[model samples]
Target: MSLLNEDATIPFISRYRKEITGNLDEVQIGEIVKFKELFEALEKRKISILKTLEEQNVLTTELSQKIHNSQDFISLEDLYLPFKKKRKTKAETARLQGLEPLAKMIMSQNVNNLEQTASKYTSKEVATIDDAMEGARFIIAEWINERTDIRNNIRRELERFATISSKIIKSKIDEEKAQKFKDYFDWNEALKNIPSHRLLAILRAENEGFIRVKIEIDSERILQRIENRIIKSQNNCSAQIEFAIQDAYKRLLFPSLSNEALSIAKEKADEDAINVFTKNLKQLLLGSPLGEKRVLAIDPGFKSGCKLVCLNEQGDLLHNENIYPHQPQNQTNEAIKKIGSLVDAYKIDAIAIGNGTASRETEELVKKIFFKDKVDVFVVSEAGASIYSASKIARDEFPNYDVTVRGSVSIGRRLQDPLAELVKIDAKSIGVGQYQHDVDQTKLKKSLDTTVESCVNTVGVNINTASESLLSYVSGIGPKLAENIVNYRNEKGSFTSRKEIKKVPRLGGKAFEQAAGFLRIKNGKNPLDNSAVHPESYVLVDKIAKDLKINIADLIGNKDILQKINLQHYVSETIGLPTLQDIVKELEKPGLDPREKAKVFSFDANIKTIADLKTGQLLPGIVNNITNFGCFVDIGIKESGLIHISNLSDTFVKDVNAIVNLQQQIIVKVLEVDVVRKRIQLALVK
Candidate 1:
């Protein structure tokens, strides 16, 4: 924790400061970072609570000790409840009427003549002794409600036995729109066992005013427990104490603890949902890339015609065309001739078709055309391509082109490299997550940012050609520094060496040191600069090359020569075997892509729509989205099929990731089809 406080990023601490952190990995270090922030927040809250109590002149030695000793916010809040100021509650009004002393006397349980004692307090304000005792009972009920031990025990009960139940708004139940949430209309489940997706669905329905939801516990059991704690004697005051206990349990404690339990459950659900979203986002971002290739991409549409753009190997848009391949303008012959000409003229390597409106028709059209060269056709997911099309990045890149052409360009680049192209769009708009919008937006963004950073750093970036969006995710470079790096490259020409990066504006020594290793400069002057070997470690590589009696260039990618060198000779106080091993590994595969090359996936030719799906029909499918429940697979149809976790394999499967991954092509057998819902259920072919 102390090490993390010194501006040390997770990757730096996990990779470089292993000795200080006992060799904790990135995930463990990230957890420590989160908890450290949590502790600081708790400390701030403690200070605020202590100051508030002191200002109210109610601070006591025992109370101060308990507050200082609290380990969680709930316990601390339970202790502070008695002193918290607020709008006039029933108990506060009674106290203002001067019934607190009488309440204290009633709680003492030593008063035999309770009515006679209450008579002494009777006045114009009291009206009658019964009224006075009633006010005392209200104060007593509040006192019972405020006891920390009592509140804590009730909280435990709520946690152990709470049930979340929802009911449709009576008038909305008959509405046609309410059918979408039919499953949750009469839902009742144990709060502890409810899955994150279902919880979020329920919340969304409640938010839309279709249903009312509440957490419930056994009220009688709670009353009995409170009575056992507060009712001490069988005297005249005992009956009043019992009444107060029941009043507190029913009116205050039960409601408060139930809400608290629901809060905890909601928080847990949010975390679970966020984790799912983060994992899905990571997989989608790191999906296979068809390395730099000339791509003719198409954004398929019916009335608007298919928006077409030809891109060079570097994803530079060279030409744009609109072809009416389907529908009202069924100029198939003209579209086919034009496509063949474009393929021949541009020397196209691959065809990327956006999996959107009229995608199947466009794909059929493209495959039917006789190209001069054999071209591999890819159906790319254009989930957020439209969002990126009208974005500022797209506008800056292609000022003369409209959104249709820009969208086609995005689809083309996404096929060329997913990580680089997808970074320009918001993660939430990618449509690869479950209940994303329902989760905590702040937490979701933080998690997605961390995931993007991890993936970007894992697969090093090309500093010379990377966009500001891609460069911004590098280790230490942010939006401003990324823009400056791009501007500096434009003005100074392509960087000949990694050291030239120091000339970029506001890129100080610290920023360069953190970011330089993850930013690759291919074909740079220094061989080690193109590799992950940090500038600080260049001396170490030079020493190895000197020992071999050869130039540094010969030392890189020479596994046989590298093997003969002794690692122990290079060990020092600062550099250890872990880093030395990493250097050797980098030398072997310097500047290599960590992702697999993209492959063409085709669905069953017979199946073009959900209506074509039949039970027991085997078909090829690509895993598109994964969740805790299952994965959604695109089987070349208008409706994607769902492979539930149970149906993923013949044996019991605990995690869906263990069985399948994003964009993995596999064969599956259809199990069921719902034509009305446009749903297909499938099982993985053994």
Candidate 2:
């Protein structure tokens, strides 16, 4: 609590102050932070409630005690419902007409003749005994509806046994666009057991004007339950109480409780969808990087010639051009000759092709052309490449180039280093999430931002070449500081050491302390600056080096020397075994990237589109998107196939990720094909 109160970041406290947090991981620490925020909100709500009650002059001893002891919002609201100011209702009209005494007489259930008692309160407003009794029942219904015990009991019943039903609007059933939701035209399910994806789909259908949804339960059972609680005696007024009980359940209780149930269900569905999105986003961000290499990337198209760019090992754009090798302008010979000459001239090591229109044809064309070196060709997802190309970041990076040229460059850079390149684009635009638009946008952004931050800090950043978007995710560096660092680098050259960052305008000691450890400068004067070791721990590293009788450079990456050093000898009051062990590990592999090296993937050449697919035919595919039901795999075609959770493995699969991951290449057997709708179903090949 104190650590969070002091505005300590999760990574800092988890890594440096292990003893205080009991060695909690980032996820556990995040939970604690979330709970603390919720508690603070609850306290504020309590204060507001107390103030409102005091102003109402209804803060009696019993009411005050109950309000103070309430633990949840539902209970507190239930206690406040009777005292809450309401609009003019039938019950309020009856009360204003001097019918309360008759209503009270009926409520007591001790009156012998209800008609005789009701006649005494008769007036111009209540002209007859039947009118007086009707007014009394209206008041009684409101009274029964506001009872805390009654509302709580009904809520429990709804939670345990509600059914959600949906039906298509007859007039819109034949609408072409509404056919996409045809599966949900007529559906009913237990609200408690509906999966998140199904619920979200149903809600989307409802929102699109295709279906009307309703929540219901056993009406007779609920009415009996309410009647048992409200009626106490079998007298003349008991019948009037029964009428009131029915009115309460039908007009008041059912509608309100059903709405509450649906709202809760929607919230749960949003949470589940957001969790899946975060997991998939994390996996895609941490996908393998094809380390620094001279490469050529192409954005394939038919009418517009393929946009191509050549990038150096440092991902700097060296050259770009347009090639017409497919359809309309098939200058095959000229294209091949130009590609070969450029590869030879630039010493290219690999080729990257965007998996869009004409991708396979371009790959075939590139493979046929021979080069001096063995150039590996890779097909990468172009989900957000276009978005980045048209963004301000792209303009800043390549002010002289057009959007097409910038986009081709982005595709190539992603192949070389995915985390570094993809961070420049928004996570939502990456197209790996499910129902992202339907869920809470603020919450989705928050989760995605955290995931990106964790990935960036885990892999560490290069101080000299990182873009502002990537650098902004560092522990303490925000947009302004990131821009400053980039500006300083551009004006004065590369950062030579960690302390040089402090010299940038608006960058103070605190920002440097939080961000320095995650920013690495290769071949710098201070070797620790290139590693995860903090500047605060440089004195300890110097001590270890001095004890070993060698230069600091010699101590780094020397496993033999690192293995012999006792971490216990370096422990101090603030530095414990965890920090010392981390330091030793960092020294062994300074600035080691956690992502794997990217590999080349290929699809079956004979199959180019959905029409070419056949049952029992084996084909290679890459997982493109994931959801609760299963994953969508791109099989080198315009239409991706669905690998339902039931078919994700030969064995029963409970979790989809336990078997496959985003961007993972695997062979699948075609099970069914619906060419009309451009859909394919596949089974995992064992």
Could you give candidate 1's per-residue lDDT for residues 269-364 as a string of tens digits?
889988888888888888999998999999999988998899999999999989997889998899999889999899999999999999988998
Shift in Å, residue 6, candidate 1: 2.7
Among these predicted structures, which one has the highest TM-score? 1
lDDT (Cα) of model 2: 0.89
Candidate 2's C-alpha runs over 4 A off are 98-101, 120-131
Model 2 over residues 1-686: C-alpha lDDT tens digits?
A: 89877666776666666868778888899889878887787677777877888998888888888888887777878888887788998899999999888888898999987788889888998899989999999999999889888888888888899999999999999999888899889999999999988899999999999999999899898788887876889988999999988988889978887898888898899988988888898899899998889999999998899998999998999999999988999989999998999889999898999999999999889989988889999998899998999999999899999999999999999899888899999999999868889988888898888888888888889989898999999888989999999999989999999989899999888678778889999988898999999998999999999999999999999999899998888877888888888999999999999888898888898998788999999999999998888999999999999999999876888888888899999999999999998889998774
Worst 10 residues of 2 by lDDT: 7-16
What is each predicted model's overall lDDT from 0 to 1?
A: 0.88, 0.89
Local error of candidate 1 at residue 146 (angstroms): 1.6
